[model samples]
Target: MKVTLKLPKPRNPLVAPARARKAGAHASYNPARKVRRTEKHKLNQALSGRKTEGSYDA
Candidate 1:
């Protein structure tokens, strides 16, 4: 016997969720993005041997 299922197509993730009732999970509301961006910025600065105003090292 063969079984099959029909599912809705995947949704776009980059657009805002509430705007025009867009599909996909909320990409903008994620709190981790800011944290990751900041962390990556610091890490990049550290790797490039650039001094920042903050006391961040390593």
Candidate 2:
């Protein structure tokens, strides 16, 4: 007598998670969106003489 072994089906890696599979789901961070400060804000910072650099200032 011969016996056959059963194996589980493999999941598809290309498939997105259930939460992401839903419609109208958007990521918190979108690269196309402008995130950096505007030129006006930069000018204000320069005028204020505030150092935006890291711990090197301390």
Best by lDDT: 1
Candidate 1: C-alpha RMSD to true structure equals: 11.6
Summarize candidate 1's per-residue lDDT along 6-46 as a digit string, tens digits. Answer: 99988877555657674676677867897898888988887
Model 2 pairs in collision = none
Give a tens-digit lDDT track for model 2, residues 1-58. Answer: 9998898898887776764766774785665443343545565666677745331221
TM-score of candidate 2 to 2 decimals: 0.24
Identify the runs in model 1 with alpha carbons over 4 angstroms from their true place. 1-26, 52-54
Candidate 2: segments with Cα more than 4 A from true spot: 1-37, 52-58
Q: In angstroms, how far off is 41's CA in candidate 2?
A: 0.1
Ten-residue region with minimum lDDT total, candidate 2: 49-58
